[model samples]
Target: MFGLWAPERPTEAAVRSEIWSLGARHQGRPLEGALAELEADEITSGRAALLRACVAKLRPAKVRR
Candidate 1:
């Protein structure tokens, strides 16, 4: 949710909270687009300001064959 030099770093607690939240949201799931098949799927944006935010978009996992 920030650009370089724009975000005001998030607190450790916030990062931890986001981690847990994302974890819960992804429980039993493949983390949305963590694979090649979901490459074109809609994405969830990262949060936590600038501490533990994930990528806003997803890159498909490469098929290793």
Candidate 2:
């Protein structure tokens, strides 16, 4: 977890968008499951931000692999 600050967007949507974006990007390839989980409210806003930060932090690993 990259310890991102609480977001500026209205609490829920910022969180939702973050989750959707993370799901679209990470959670392994072919993101159907991640998208579904995000849609299902499996991720909280704080968690989404954290996950987003983590994914961003680890992106260099993806490039190297």
| Model 2 misplaced stretches (Cα beyond 4 Å) | 1-40, 61-65
Error of 1 at 56 (Å): 14
lDDT for each candidate structure: 0.42, 0.50
User: What are the root-mean-square deviations of the candidates from the true structure over C-alphas?
Assistant: 8.3, 10.6
lDDT by residue for model 1 (1-65), tens: 35764646556666555545555667723334133222434533333232223322222457799
Q: What is the TM-score of each candidate against the true structure?
A: 0.38, 0.33
Stretches of candidate 1 exceeding 4 Å from the true structure: 1-5, 28-48, 51-65
Which residue pairs collide, candidate 1? none
